[model samples]
Target: MKFASTGLTALLLASVAVPASAETLRWARAGDALTLDPHAQNEGPTHTLNHQIYEPLVLRDEEGTLVPALATDWHVSEDNPNVWVFELREGVTFHDGAEFTADDVVFSLNRAMTEDSDMKELLSSVKEVRAADTYRVEIETEGPNPIMPANLTNMFIMDQEWAEANDAVEVQDYEGGEDTYAASNANGTGAYRLVSREADVRTVLEQNEEYWGADQFPMDVTRIEYTPIQNPATRVAALLSGEVDFIQDVPVQDLGRVSQAQGLEVETAPQNRTIFFGLNVGADDLQTDNIEGENPLANRQVREAMNLAINRDAIRQVVMRDQSIPAGVIAPPFVNGWTEELDQISTDVDRAKALMEEAGYGDGFSIQLDCPNDRYVNDEAICQAAVGMLAQIGITVNLDTKPKAQHFPLITGFTGDETDFYLVGWGVPTFDSAYIFDYLVHSRDEEYGSWNATGYSNPELDAKIEGLASETDLEARNQAIAEIWEVVQDETMYLPLHHQVLNWGMTDNIDVPVDPEDQPKFKRFALN
Candidate 1:
């Protein structure tokens, strides 16, 4: 399971070959997958890497259409409204030659609900999972969940036998810094097989010769070499120099340069992610701030002042190079509950200063801002810009920037001492506002709030958010969604920034669509 030190170098050298048929794809991104454990992290790049080796029951196509993957068909049980029945696809085999069956589905779903699993919140409604037969399985939820299928699009299924044999039944404690067998090794019924993996360095995957969908899909790619290039200039240089064939993130500053280069093309798409700032409003006292005896973020006037002080337009134009869409709400435009009225906030530094003074902090205060340098596009630069803008209103900011691997734990409910202020980006995979309310806005608890490092909690809003899961009436569910947003907007629980835009740079011979979720399935790719 461990990668040989010299094997990665040999693989990297072999990856430069350009077959006449485009059989190999050298892919690079800003950050590497945290772990190969399917249930370990809910991160975008991690999911993108795992998708090549593990698959969920259902998946989203290039156009965001839901399609069956491991499961052939699924529906609610006629007799029991709270139970859903899924028909597993037959003739599918794991890379280890084990047959895919209902037991794997049952086990994988239960594993995803374990306490250590980052995917637990997505399956909070599930009461139990039962395998009816070799290829049939049933899931009983706590209540009737109309959109249960939507939740399974990213819940990857792991082979029960493979996990038990390898003693990897427990999900890796990524946040706790505990590495397990699953962290470095993988076994799944995906399109590609893991040939070698050297964390943060290189990972090699070859086509699964016995893949069940070999005949169904074009299977254009025979080999995949993935690299994690953290530096923007280095990433673009690799692509421009033909050291890499494709890169998921094409820096805005180099988009024109890359596009103009011969044999290179840039594909752009509106991402479904929103980047924003989180404040510890629920804390009684701040840990990283100089304010004494009280938390400044707890003051509504102060929070509103911070929100008004931010100029999203400037960040969009200067930092994002006019590639991002300025946003007024945390939820993106694609989500159901988004409205123009809710997304119409304007910047006013004068009003912001007035609010700060009205809150009895005319002299201002100092706090630290934690940000990730490699996670989002210009993530660190964006935080640096915020520091300057907040300084205008007398709020001195000490910015701490690090790689996402080290920076994410500050906000992912890992450390006891969470960051008082931080920058994070979120994407709505389920295409619902309830996803936002459940994780970001809800009160911190064992089941939910794993990502709500802000410490903001309200019992009334928590009940409404939990209700969205079982509310079968579409209108009623949407009403609850709107009510939750109203409170979120009024409280300024998160300082909304802007929606990110995706730019993928690849060789002219490669043809792949930009996925809104930022996950590109290599199996569906075609090379001209």
Candidate 2:
């Protein structure tokens, strides 16, 4: 009888403690992850997961300012603007019990500069990443770069010894999956640890009890399950049905339904991302056969014509369901030092037609347009809408929509000396206009390296981008950006659509902070 009474008491304690202390937040979304290797891909669902798995040297605050993360404090060299010194927080240890040190930072950064790595170009400006001491490191840049912290925000630090032990040294080839050592396995000095991964189905993460940080409210959230439910309707249904706690990429159409749900609430925040279309400016030949020229997009007039034909307002209303704000330039509002002068693009169809006629295409021609089906919110639908709009100007668009997995390689692969006209969205990690100039405006041969997929090249723009990168004076950098924006608009190398809103539906039990930059962090969330 005494043993039975003791067992009953133990069961009562388990009932109260299990639900209170060991809560598992089941989050759902409508996209599959490309890879878990943080350096392999720069965008999409992986970004959200990576946020939970890894902590970079720096993180952007709510106001888009760079704040320390892994590093406790840092200082820019007074003598040389290119040199940045950082003081590492001592006593921080990786999940595998490996100590965090300067060597890990150097290994992760140097590996990021490998040729085969997709994110190699992000760290291309760094001349050297050397350890000044065990608790400090200094990054010497190839030139005077102001946006160093912003650029390196996504360069998550890895365990050098752990990586070497697992034979994960060549970070370029690490694709986290069934056949890889890094797949469903991780060893980071972050707040969580990867417990299990079921591809396209679910990923489970457990709180790192050994995390050397301030106490987390859900100190032991044993199993946070992340599931990718592709259909928007199904995802929303699951949320309303109490199957999931949170659902991302909430369809704009169902915002009303979600908002009206009994225990659910809807949240909308401006994401520092720009959705745009790239014309094949650098390609030797146009993908379409109707244009009989050497390179149709190469003609400044032709590029402008394509831009004006698409009614961005209609796309914002219909395709995006009014969830997007029309964009004038590549850089969005939240990006630091972004000016109003940069938002200068004419939406005149008649002028565009005149330009097209001058370029010898009075009647528009047929072309194949490439789009990613799973990359953005309603990405494929947006492309379909664009096809109809382009058709109005006699431009017959053969839309070739593919999943991001298949789409990224074919178009972004510059090896074939080709890239078809395609649609893409860039969420600027650095939250700076310099990111725009460096990635899109600067030439592939330059110090920062290549993100110029369209092959849009101009000597004037290159000089302006270079000037902005190195310019210490705030006004001087802004002036350089203004000049670069003017040249880009004049050339019409890209068609800017709108900065789409990120809609999320969640229970009011948690406080999820919103930053226009969309860092995907819930640094202060807790269950009521």
Candidate 3:
């Protein structure tokens, strides 16, 4: 679907309404957005919050279909196959009343490619971004990129004028623990505007009256009251007591209670996210383990043993409350490179013990398992369960749990490794396997491997992973993808857990679909 092309004056006049009829939506979740700066953190919750206030060149609808946003139309330039052209939407204005133009598009794309931007990995193929005209921009890549548009769905545009005036042109150094004005303030050309922000506490937003698509969408929600409720009981109670109108993270343990409550309903869908365990296999000596001067994870047999020790079925039934699909591969089914052969693994404690004994560790060792309590559904609980399962194989685990804000840094920061074993979740925004290899399996470097805490790197695999970006032939590209997955599976780089199932609890009065990405845009919402 495309945006309405009728003149903006008609759109504004048709959307104007009395304030007395305005509807307010109270939303609660387990964790808050990491920052208001669009390029600061490439996290799910942060992108969800920014989707309301920031306008990207392209966006995904509730069904994960790509749609035009800031750009009305886009296509590869006929004269230059390596260049992509984007035509901007007319009569659009930023939240601060700044005019939207190609300059802002060029600036925002360039800003997102900077060293401090966590979004740099998505634009690694772009060679340059230049404005062709007042409302047209061209992005030149090093090679022909057939799926370039897929990469821009989350590349939000920022107002160059507002950024420079506020000294916020530089993206916030989130991993380095630096804060800037843009971290707390926002200015964009989306359907909503930020009214106030109190980090980790509350953020309020009001509908954009002069929004370009005011009449193009339902725009039923006039105000949004977003709160981060970490406690599962409090989040459910807020919904039951009418303190909040909606919640995205409905705890699996309380799904029955919420659905049985009066005036409430639970909507569910399969999420495109995978939860898994990462081991620091690259280290010569485990930093967080009792086995000194030797890394047990460094042995392939040991890693395979750990994978066998995990009872994915048990975790799915007990820890996830049957709300997750036990997975054998790191990539979800929605991604291009996933296959049944790659998604098949079995649990065998006896085999795991034998592998440990074969690897010269007859007496099992102990290690620390770092996990986030609020990031994934039953994240901490999953680690705790793994601790017990590993104990059956004589391997003791020390579980350390904390909020996501504190746990994410141990993996993403540029500093030295801080985790020996960790529980983490990954979602493929680009819906491709290259996204997985580049960040997780590739060697840690400046451009890629920002999330690879495993310390595992293979030069041959790295070359194959990088080749996917420029490989245009679909047949050959898929072949290479399959080959890479074969190696990744054999190496047992990560212990795959399961694909999460989404459960959204809301009042019956609101009509909205559960997004597989777990991001629900209020502009598409309606009061039934």
Candidate 4:
């Protein structure tokens, strides 16, 4: 009976395996966009492809725990928290068969730090990348970087020799929707090779049989295809119509529709993504350069009032259809080590009203609220809900909604210019609270961090963050992070919102892992 069961298992697996001649797997997404360079964009689609074609020195497991990838093992120097030594796996080859070495790692680090790279901000303190030998590398950071391994997970390594050969040694200064070779062409040491990219239509990748880690999985999948179908309804339609195998970012409104589909399965997981409104505190008033009848938002009382006025619970229920959990901090609870002391601000409208009145705004004034219509799950509707709630508190909000493409450039562009107030979602790639304090709350130094978009800055908090970055002691570091959060919350840099939830729809034949990191990767997925 055991022998018969084994035979049946083998037969089932063989039946699902694609023939060697079937070289392409058709994949689909919301739309065609963004630069092809892995470092060009921090969005989900970019990460999805980056994980496929580029290999990070370190990677995270399904549980969001750190794991070794290109680097076989690593150690921190006893003398300095700033120094990290990594031993590379020998005998690994880039997609072009060029030998992987320490030089390539160093070159990749330098390129990622180049001013042209959008990814440069992510590794501002990486002082230098030096090779100890052909198969070993040492990174000397400006300060203690406990999140080095996690941060490195996003730095996809490129071949130094091949890049130099093609004059692509430098990361191109390409913006989303811009055409560049790095966007169109891919050369890396990952498990797949780019076969063709037909803009919005589809991107095709073939199995890299020569991949050094080929034995890691029973890789019967020979091809992967990516298509962008931005509309949630359309995406679900395609999956149900059998035109695509998998679909992500399923709208909560359509959960019932997709769940009822025959031969399909819906898998849902809580994401670490936080969707919140970013009030441009630095802006003196609305973008129109005039203060409207007692600008309540121009005062701290008004800002806090705005925070208290909205009920996140209701937004989760009505807009998200109970698909999301209310958030208290920027870092989600699942980020593990960081969210132990997570606390939510009070949702007392009475206090909010009193504060607004004390700020000399007995009568509320009008202000424009910008929102990205297509960015996060039910993003626009959430903003609409906030507007309605704020209106009840006597603040009149003029809603201006646009796609992320137009919204981001106008609000949080390189100039530190932002809309009066806008809704934005943040995912801490390092899964650390320091990312919130350093980038968001510090200052938009451009060279340093991301969270400072609101132009929120506190010298004392900055110093604490600086000290924590290099502190080797885990207790001390965690304490420092807690302090930073206290300062951010007390000062109201960003109104804390709930962590997001991801719901993906797929056919029974496809199996995909759900990661709170929110990067939709298909390398490990298989046909059941």
Winner by lDDT: 1
Ordered from best to worst lDDT, the candidate numbers read: 1, 3, 2, 4
lDDT of 3 by residue, 1-528 (tens): 011122322332344322223389888888889999999888889999999999899887877788889988999999999999999998999998989999999999899989888788778888999999999999998888777888887789999999999999999988788999999999999989999998777899999999999888999999998978777776777777777788999999999999999889999999989999998988888777888898999999989999999999999999889999999999999899999888987999999999999999869999999999877888888999999999988889999998888888888873445888888898887888988888889888867788888888899999888888878899999999999999999998799999989999998888998888888899988987
Clashes of each: 0, 0, 0, 16
Which regions of candidate 3 are displaced past 4 Å? Answer: 1-22
lDDT of each: 0.89, 0.73, 0.87, 0.72
How far residue 210's Cα lies from its native spot in candidate 1, in Å, is 0.9
* For model 3, the run of ten residues with the poorest summed lDDT: 1-10
What lDDT tens digits, residue by residue, belong to model 4 across residues 7-109? 4223322344332233344555443445567666655556767788888888887788888889999888777778889999898888788899999999888
Best by TM-score: 1
TM-score of each: 0.96, 0.90, 0.95, 0.89
Looking at candidate 4, the ten consecutive residues that score lowest on lDDT are: 1-10
Once superposed on the true structure, which residue ranges of model 1 sit more than 4 Å away at CA?
1-21, 414-416
- What are the per-model C-alpha RMSD values against the true structure? 2.9, 7.5, 7.5, 7.7
- lDDT tens digits, residues 84-130, model 2? 88899899899888899999999888877775455765676688999
Better of 3 and 4 by lDDT: 3
Error of 1 at 198 (Å): 0.9
